[model samples]
Target chain A: MISDSPLLKLALTFGALSLVSVGGAPAMMPEIHRLSVEVNPWLSNAGFARDFALSQTAPGPNFMMISLVGWRVAGFAGLMAATLAAIIPSSIIALIVGRLYMRFSSQAWFPVVKDALPPIVLGLIVASGVVTAQAAVSDTLGFAIVIMSTTIVALTRQNPLVAIATGAIIGLAAGRLGYL
Target chain B: MEQSADSSKTASGRPLGKLELFTGFAEMGLFGFGGVATIARHIIVDKRRWMSEHDYAAVLGLGQILPGGNIINMTVMLGDRFHGPLGSIIALSGLMIMPIVILLGLTLVYDAYAANPDVRAATIGAGAAAAGLVIGMGLKMGRALRLHPIHLGFAVTTFVAMGVLRLPFIATIIVLAPLCIAATWWMRKR
Candidate 1:
């Protein structure tokens, strides 16, 4: 029996996460991993990892993983609830504050706030990278793939999807060769 | 205000109608694999000429400071800029609709292949690459900022607090963001 309560909880949790998802969805990964895996037991670590990969591969916002988690927990209704929860609150704030910022484009505090945010956003992103790498990298081959993909994506204009797809093909070949 | 200037320019030029906004974002949603920011800029600034380069950057800057997904916020702001409240709704929904359906389909496919060893291995590989993507994005953004010492310190501190120590996310931000903001203001003075 799928209870309304868990779905509601899912909505509430993601709704709160929506407000703090600075820099984008990836910034919230560590917390999202902890909450869904440790706090709620809604997903195992591996399950969370797989869903994270799915979200990454999909052509949308990285935060779409939250919806996947909700779906895993409670099906379609959970999906809708979590997706809306993840998008709505912060969007409302964006709409309101965005309008105001346009009006106050020359305010003294605006540029200061903007300049200060990038570093912090960078930090959060790095933290998310750490959390995700810990969860995702399991073997030597996986580590190598991470290093290669990171190098290629950072140093060149190569499409990231190509890198990701290459990683997948390598994994498939490795699995067939009994590397796993 | 720069917003008024951009708005007036948009008004004078061929303004984006609701359907165009929807179709444009829908296309972005479908093909914008990895990150949507570049593709969005291409569509909005280059292909469509809906916004000038400066206007696009300014809007993107504002989007970054606010909460939620940056692209999602971009959709809202861009939508509102052209079409008011209804425009915002249409743009956001367009951005989400196709991706949501496709993701749901992918999830179902993943569940069906969950037990396969090959599929599991490929997922692991994909996951590693995904992590790389995140790290690369951080490095790229950090380089772009040309971070001063203070900013670098704050960024490293944040990484330590959350990545190393595994502190709570919201609490760390609450404690650190104000300090960083003040430091930036002080740096500006000098």
Candidate 2:
């Protein structure tokens, strides 16, 4: 039903996500996944997973997934709508809040609000990780790739691009072996 | 510290030109593959000397608390700081324009190649790694918080509700966020 006018749907969905996307783009992954895959059926689970992967591989903000989803659903118009919708609302809010904060930075309530946000944001990020991991990992090799990549990223200050490249190679090999 | 001081000495000590703001953020947008936060810090505080480290941190903190992408929010704030609404618009354009074009091009290539077995496999692998990156980021952020017991409890509850139980994101945030804030406020008052 919502898919009928996918451009409008894409704009509204992404715009809504934009406002609530505390901690950044990744923080809103679960909702993005839910809206795109489950509610709207814009992308299948695997398709959404693939788009998510592509977003990470592409340069720029992780929020690029919104653009990819738009492109997949409705071409260039959809992409523009989704990207602009996802960015503009929050950007405006930030401008207003930034102005206000600059004026009232020393107020007592400011630090309290600041102190409270990190844990909640952390939780949201962890939830997003779980959602993506569930979508991506299925087999033993997939599990291994996830674990290895996690270890590499967690233990070392290495660029995450290395882990992504390594995972791609491993997956290619597994695919050649018909294990994937 | 030393690097920051040296950069400040060399800085032109003028409000950034609109073009300069655009180019600076555009560079960060282009090369900020995994994330732009660190690169933004380098440009804004360490290299450009536009803001002190303390000021940058404060702005970054505010960005995190607000909605949308952190870097985008930072750009908005930074741009406004120098040149108000028009400056903010330029900063956002500079940050998004090149990357949008590049991503669209990549999307076209991806769509064309998506049917291939190799492409499928590579995407799967990259997806898994991307998931890992998310987890790694969560772990790092979680560790950095050094959460108090109450904060940990809230974090765990949030994880369970949102991640494990698959609760609706908006509802969960609305319910949990204010509670967490009140808890912190109480903790601070004591």
Candidate whose lDDT is highest = 1
- How high is each candidate's TM-score? 0.95, 0.94
The candidate that achieves the highest TM-score relative to the unseen native structure: 1
- Kindly report the fnat of each predicted structure, to 2 decimals: 0.74, 0.71
TM-score of chain B, per candidate? 0.92, 0.90
Off by over 4 Å in 2: A1-4, B1-12
Which tens-of-lDDT digit does each residue in A22-121 have in candidate 1? 8878788888988898789898867877888888888967788898988998899989999999999999998888788656677898899999998998
The DockQ scores of all candidates, in the order shown, are 0.71, 0.59
Best by DockQ: 1
Q: In model 2, state the lDDT of residue B18.
A: 84
Provide the lowest-lDDT 10-residue window in model 1 chain B. B1-10
Off by over 4 Å in 1: A1-4, B1-12
Summarize candidate 1's per-residue lDDT along B1-92 as a digit string, tens digits.
23554583452387678899999999888888886777888888888788888878888888888888788998998898888878889998
